[model samples]
Target: MEMLTLECPYCGVQADETELHAGGEAHLTRFGPGSSDADFEAYLFMRENPKGVHFERWRHVNGCGKWFHAARCTMTLEVFGTYPAQTAEPPKKIRDAITAKRPGWTWRELS
Candidate 1:
């Protein structure tokens, strides 16, 4: 495993992996009290572990102390870009970067 570095979207600081905490996959649908047990279980545990491009949540624990989203490649560990956590989807710039590196790549039908 190589050392991972990510830029904090809020603070614009390039931070090493030690300064950040991974928060698992991003853009998950939350299932609450009224939801079925299976839905809740899937919400909590199920995740897409793709071999290629992946979107993930990361917290800049030692920088801005804020969460952000990162589009990266699982196989090569190449980060496409990072964006604010509040965004509902990957920004066009990030998506373009990924597509430039990997043509025909799609993220949950957002290709």
Candidate 2:
């Protein structure tokens, strides 16, 4: 039997890939007509290419279908914490949880 461990980016649970789902990139906010080329570049390409801690958007496509932000370290492929997406501000628990699990990881709330 073959299995891969996956983290649920919404509920902060670690389970087999069978129990979780993969969603694409996070923090994709659209720009207005007056935006500059640099702004477009920043939006399209110059975003975080982090090696260690990174914030990504994912969905529990199999479980709840809710979007979430995953605090992950790409170098180690470790998911320290996950929180609900579309949050106006990261809840204290989410911030604390990420800090406790992966220090120096920043979680930005996306609208």
Candidate 3:
């Protein structure tokens, strides 16, 4: 199996893929009880899987055991930046970098 590495923003640890776990798309707002069926459904299954800049969640499972968010390009597989998982939106620096690389990119607070 090919090996990969992801840096943990919280602990500053560089861990191999085996030491990390993917948590899926990041910055997802929870659709709790009482949410409309449509909202729940969207939360359960909807994802852009966008071809360009994408935000994702990951954990340093075998290392710091902390979760963090990563902004990466789905096409090029290049990571633009990583930030704490608790953040509700992409950091400004990361957004700027993405804009610089992918001109005319639209950034959404909840996408």
Candidate 4:
């Protein structure tokens, strides 16, 4: 049987690809509603041409429904780290709001 290797960022596990799912290219950030034609063209056609240190968004499609981030060296196919999907900047505002609501909760204390 052919086996593919994948590294899980959330749990810091490196296992067969059967345990994960490739969620397609990760560089698709948001575009404003008023973006011009060039913006649309770039979003649709130009993204994720990486040689090294690429941040990819993937899901533990088989193990967990949660999405996570992966830092990979594309040239050598080496995965550096994986972190929970919430770590991606898209959720920063929400995370900040939640953090702000938690009175007297310091990051140092949590750690």
Highest lDDT among the candidates is held by which one?
Answer: 1
TM-score of each: 0.90, 0.62, 0.87, 0.61
Stretches off by above 4 angstroms in model 3 are 1-4, 107-111
Ranking by lDDT: 1, 3, 2, 4
Task: Report model 1's TM-score to 2 decimal places.
Answer: 0.90
| Number of clashing pairs per prediction, in order | 0, 0, 0, 1
Which residue pairs clash within candidate 3?
none
List model 1 lDDT by residue over 1-111, tens digit each: 698889899999999999999999998989999999999999999888889999999999988899999999998889999999998788899998999999999767578
The reply for model 2, stretches above 4 Å from the true place, is 1-25, 88-111
User: lDDT of each prediction vs. the true structure?
Assistant: 0.92, 0.63, 0.82, 0.57
Q: Which stretches of candidate 4 lie over 4 Å from their true place?
A: 1-13, 88-111
The runs of at least 3 residues in candidate 1 whose Cα sits more than 4 Å from the true structure, single-residue gaps closed, are: none
Which 10 successive residues of model 2 have the least lDDT summed? 102-111
lDDT of the structure predicted as candidate 3: 0.82
Query: Which 10 consecutive positions of candidate 1 have the poorest summed lDDT?
Result: 102-111
Winner on lDDT between 2 and 4 is 2
Q: Which lDDT tens digits does candidate 2 get at residues 17-50?
A: 5665555456566665789987877667756666
Q: Across residues 2-50, which tens digit of lDDT does each residue of candidate 4 receive?
A: 4546666565566566677777555465566889988878777775655
